[model samples]
Target: MPTLAEQLQTALRQETAVAQRLYEVMAQEQSALQRMDSASIQALAQEKSRLLAALDQQLLARQKLVPNHQVEGAVDALINTFPAAIANPLQQAVDQLRELLFRCHNQNEINGRIISASRRSVERSLSLIRGHQPDAVLYTQNGGATRMGPNRRFASA
Candidate 1:
């Protein structure tokens, strides 16, 4: 049986993994948005929704372990590391994003600021669609069919 401390630590670590995976998936979805098609966007939207939901659930579970979990590593370190810590699984989770940010842009390392900046970049791009083209149109690859909906169209080009 895992001690409470160990169990909590494991849970905390898992939260970090969940956040990174979510970020990666969101990034991919954002890139896919460029195709200007409904089906792809729609699928991405669905996947994003699912990922967000799972993240939410994981967050809730993490919270249950948060109050007493910081025996060796901190729970907040994993969740709030944002820009200063190891958004990557291989790094040590830090306390603040500023520490990560100080690593310099060219540092190309896992720190709070750098991680936060990258996350913000992905977020900004995702926000672009929501801002400029909330109601943009999309066409399919072969230009065979065209459908109109929120992020769900694939018309033949």
Candidate 2:
């Protein structure tokens, strides 16, 4: 049987790999969002979900290996319990995993902004097609600004 350190190391490696893959997927997702590629976006979303689950599982495996796993900074605390030889490499691995996860988070936020902008555009288009004027600020001939009413006509028949 492998030692506790060995098992934790293995689990951390797996988690890092999964996080790296997730970051790549998020990058692809950003590209797809920019191009408005629905098909690729849908497929990438599924892959991202699977990778996320795998990451969670790996984290659980690591948690099981360490006592007091629920405590904040548990992994670092566990690493500190080991000798320098083992602890150093484990700390490096943890740092790499953190960097990957951080990149994934940033990319996901950018993608979300893209999605929100796209949704707003579509909604605006739909409102125009449905003969509804979306809320808008209009400047009058008297150099005054006024809020458009909901019942205002968008176009003439």
Q: Which ten residues in a row have the lowest lDDT in candidate 2?
A: 147-156
Per residue, candidate 1 scores C-alpha lDDT tens digits across 1-157 of 9754455456656655655555555555545544445587578668767766876676677667565554545554544543433344323433222242332222323333444676677776775545433445456688764544555423334
As for candidate 2, its clashing pairs are none
Model 1 lDDT, full chain set: 0.52
lDDT of 2 by residue, 1-157 (tens): 9887899889889999899999999999999999999999999999999999998998888889989989889889989999999999999988998898889889889999999999999999988777676577677899998876777665668
What ranges in model 1 sit over 4 Å off?
68-91, 94-157
Scored against the true structure, residue 74 in model 2 reaches a CA lDDT of: 85
Highest TM-score scorer:
2
RMSD of 1: 15.0
Single out the weakest 10-residue window by summed lDDT for candidate 1: 97-106
